[model samples]
Target: MSNDFYTSSILPYAAIIVKICRAYTNTQEDFEDYYQEVCLQIWRSRKNFNGQSEWSTWIYRLTLNVCLTLLKKKDRQHVASDYLPDEASEGSHVFADESLNQLYDAIKQLSEVDRGIILLYLEEKSYKEIADIIGSNTNNIGVRIKRIKERLKKLLNGKVN
Candidate 1:
């Protein structure tokens, strides 16, 4: 693709990519590093597009793979949760943001595979799509999601192990 095409089409999605990276990384520096790695992977995979899925979908999958692999390599230590816009603006008083952040904090405590599933679920990706991206089957997603939800709830309730 031409530089113009990349700049116009791909670069604009940088924020969404950053958001995804934030969910995949715990530290500010790791977030930036992972974001750059996503860029490099996208560039490397640009010509490999087979047009089987939408371009956006392909980008999502590619970046997700990059993130999950990174998580695996690091043993899924921790990752940041996204705060709602208003909560982010206000900086620490909103119940909803606190709840969501707490939930994410709990999620960060999960095994890497579980964390990957929960992260995708929070992103609202469908089971089938998640399965495709995560290399799992649809049937397994439900049970896994249920268990993960229960675990998060326990964590939020301060039932820490």
Candidate 2:
């Protein structure tokens, strides 16, 4: 990707990409890798964007799709434990809040689709917007969000086994 594109097009939305990537990755290294791939894919696929939806919406959909797809591929090509980072590298800001960390840890436990749904919901996207991004029925999105919230509450309370 060009530096101009990275700075102008992708960098402006890096926070969104980072949040989506964080939801899908367990380790700092994995988060970096997924973030990079998502940026690359977004640039490569930019032409395919027809401007039917808002730019942020398109970016959200692209980020979630890239993270989930890369996660599945990573699962198939498992790396040895020795290669994994021992402790998270210190710049990620994800651990800044004790409660936020717990919330995300719980979010990470959700299935891929559920994780994306909850992340979008947490972003304050309306149910209709989330349905548009996730390509689910709006009515179903409300039901799913309610269920995901309950699941997350249980997770937070240490009730999930």
Each model's Cα RMSD: 6.6, 3.3
lDDT of 1 by residue, 1-161 (tens): 46876697579777657656666665666677888888888888888999887676677778878987886666545344442222332333212466665655566677767876787787788998778767889989988999989988887788875
How high is the CA lDDT of each candidate model? 0.71, 0.85
Cα deviation at 102, candidate 1, in Å, is: 2.5
lDDT per residue, candidate 2, 1-161, as tens digits? 89998999899889889889988776767888899899999999999999999988999999999998997787678766633321332344345786777777788778899999998998899999999999999999999999999999998999985
Relative to the true structure, candidate 1 reaches a TM of: 0.71
Off by over 4 Å in 2: 79-94
Best by lDDT: 2
